[model samples]
Target chain A: MANDKSSMQLVANGILKENPIFRLALSMCPAVGISTTVMNGFMLGVAVLFVQVCSSLTISMVKKVIHPRIRIPTYTLTIATWVTVIDMVLAAYMPEAYAKMGIFVKLIVAFAIITMRLEMFACKEPVGASFWDGLGMGLGFMIGMMTIGLVRELLGSGAILGYDVLGFKPLLFFILPSAGFFVVGLMMAFFNYIELYYKRKKGFKS
Target chain B: MKNIITIIIRLTLSCLLAAFVMGIFFVMTSKAKKHNEHVNEEKVMYSLLGYKVGAPVPETVKLYAVYRYIVTDPAGKSIGYLVPTGQGAETGFSFIILDLDGKLIEQKPVTVTADDAAEAESRDKAIKAALGAGKEAVYADDKTIIVTDNGARTAYLLSGKFAGFKASISVMLALKTDFGIRGLAIVEHEEDPGLGAEIEKGYFKNQFIGKSFATLKTLDVVKEPLPDAYAKAMEGVKGEDGGKILEQYKDHAIYALTGATISSRAVTNGVKGTVAKFAYRINILDNVLKEQHIVVPF
Candidate 1:
């Protein structure tokens, strides 16, 4: 109902305010599974971004005709199609990444974050707005995953993007899945703190 | 209601469009994907055979089992078999050990968890204990792959995997016709790219070349630099000390990656298990071949 903001704002909001990982807490499995390294995170994020954008655009353009009762199935099928296309493209052009992430790419068809956006945002918003929202959310997710990957790789393996910098691991826990929760928690807290500080400086409720 | 029918039509139309697009993509990529995997398999086979790029690969027939490739020369003489790759427990593999005439000592299921191979019990010792004496080795299954070439039945290509620092690392080992370790390839791995991933490089794999299963079975991952003796031998100029160094480690040593002890050890354990399994299978094959009066060259 509130569609007054520019497309840029919608995209920005997904990154800063409604980030699927840090803000909304959707699709944590992939966010953690592939976040073992910055490169892994970056690659997965790029993939999700493409699927999310394509699915969102498809859903938004067809919203008027989608019967509410059958909407979930329609959107799911839509996302699966896009994911398949992306997987084929990757296999054709980027054999290395295709090999590394072939399974995960197929799994993206079922990613909750992509589905949730189709249901909640794209169905309600216009096509252009939904496209921006998907892009923003996808970018925000990529950044969040990259952040987790950087910390984990640097501490768990003493490397970043697979390159050794520290010469030794500092904390192995950070790279494991359990520690992934902590990275997300810490980032959430940091962002929340920043928001609260700004709120207080503006004389608003913290 | 008419609304229900309308929704059905919309869903059907959308699905149709999506299917059309995906169908086009499938047509474009399916052939290439299958072909790529086939070429890779051929390459792995040739590398194991030490064949040159343009050299002819023996003709092949399918042997259905856990693994699928069986090779024969142009004259229809037996060459070898190719073991299919698979995940066993957790680490990667598809390998093995032995003398031309020696029977497999035994096969034991070895778990290489950090706890089992941890302090006091050297990882190799723990492995020895697991495999020692009367532990009955499991029969050949999908996890272990062996290629029994007729030229030298003692030789084989064995593959295995292990949990590395970050992810699973898969390796292929080529045993020469004379029971010598020949070529090595890291088929797949998800280790940290630059640091842990060095396992795929020439230097690491080359270590296995010229080494044999007997020596590798007792190998330990030493953290120190290559000793002067071994260093000398490695420099292609073997002095007396270098020969002594080689002698010392010939049956038991591997240098850990500069910063990847965990991954290095994992690879060692995975390869060790594979050799053990291969040796056992070769022994079985040798018995059968002997009854048939087949000769495996030394």
Candidate 2:
């Protein structure tokens, strides 16, 4: 809204500045459930990205016609359409992955990030800008999810992306829900530290 | 009127748009989603009865749905009904396919949940306690062993058809002997956020590996009447600490839980009930086999 941020900036911001899980912490449902494995985390991230991008474009194109009272439902309908499509496609072609991801694939309908972008950015923006914003945010979510999943998988399971790495005896506790909080907190703290260092040294403000 | 018309038009347009997109989406993904569901059902089926499953599963078998059919002998006479029953708890449910012939099936324990709340709560607590003590691994302690959990407020029996069902009664058989603990789901009387709640701790339930029904009856922990013949039969099995104590009584008669005797007895009875049910049917089948002079694995 301030500078009509360019597509490149939006993309970079999603990766670092306004990350869905690490920075803004939006779309947590799948983040918690599918972060058990790196492959699951990546697959879920891509699914979210697909839904987010499609919903954003649709919402932007119809922004002028949608009334305020009906806008929320309109956006949800759009998101759910994309989610069902992705869910069905995954289930058909990649049954094993679909099983591993389970209900989280269908849960993208309620992922706040999709609707949030539609309301806060896409509704007021042009189609191109809205598309970029959605893409960036989705990628940011992917990054955050992948980071957490990588750490958890590596420590809790001694694997990364289904490949055995480090071969450390897993701390079984890390795989459970309680350890989820611990892993996410440490990652967020680490992100904050990096952000602070960059800001202090380079005067970075995006 | 114009303002109202605009609102109505906007609402209608959005709804229509949503429906259109959703319809297209469904059309595109329907086949794949159905396929995925089919595969999952197949996986569950494979886990349940692979040995009996002919080399290739028939494409027509719908894994998600439970169907009842009659099981017939090779001679084409009906022997029993194959009933697929599913039971659910708060966490999840399991589907069990049972073959039943009359009174024998009625006596069989089909892994039912507790209708009573008190038993459920205590059983849950016990599971938590045993798991919290870093005892997740369990092994076969001995045949006909009696495992009593003072903390669990329940008891369990290991061996026989009783091992097939899931519930508090399952605590005794679910024990991972290698780890020396009962699985977290079966134990009752576990504490919250304490040693008991740690499902991974693996302690009290693990102690049963070397002990047996005969050993339990003779120990200071319990005082119950068990046949000496049963004791003699179980005398050779050893407990984890490495002694003939467990082996000697591995296959002894029934073992009883002492402090939480009711819970223990329930598990024992539940197991015995399960075995009786299965054995009765098997025996009937055995008799049939003998009459036919047919040799097959029982």
Top candidate on TM-score is 1
lDDT of 1 by residue, B214-289 (tens): 7776767888765545555654474757555555655557777766778778887777776777666555555644
- By DockQ, who's the top model here? 1
A1-206, model 2: which lDDT tens digit per residue? 54467889988887788888888877766676668667778998999989889988988898877888778878888888788778777777887677556578888889888888888998998889888989999898887888888888888768787677877636756665577678887888998998788788887773
Interface RMSD of each: 3.1, 5.2
State the lDDT at A73 in candidate 2: 76
Q: What is the TM-score of chain A alone in each candidate?
A: 0.95, 0.93
Model 2 chain A poorest 10 in a row by lDDT: A168-177
Q: Residue by residue across B71-136, what tens digits does model 2's lDDT show?
A: 233333233311122222222211111234432221111232332211334433433343344222
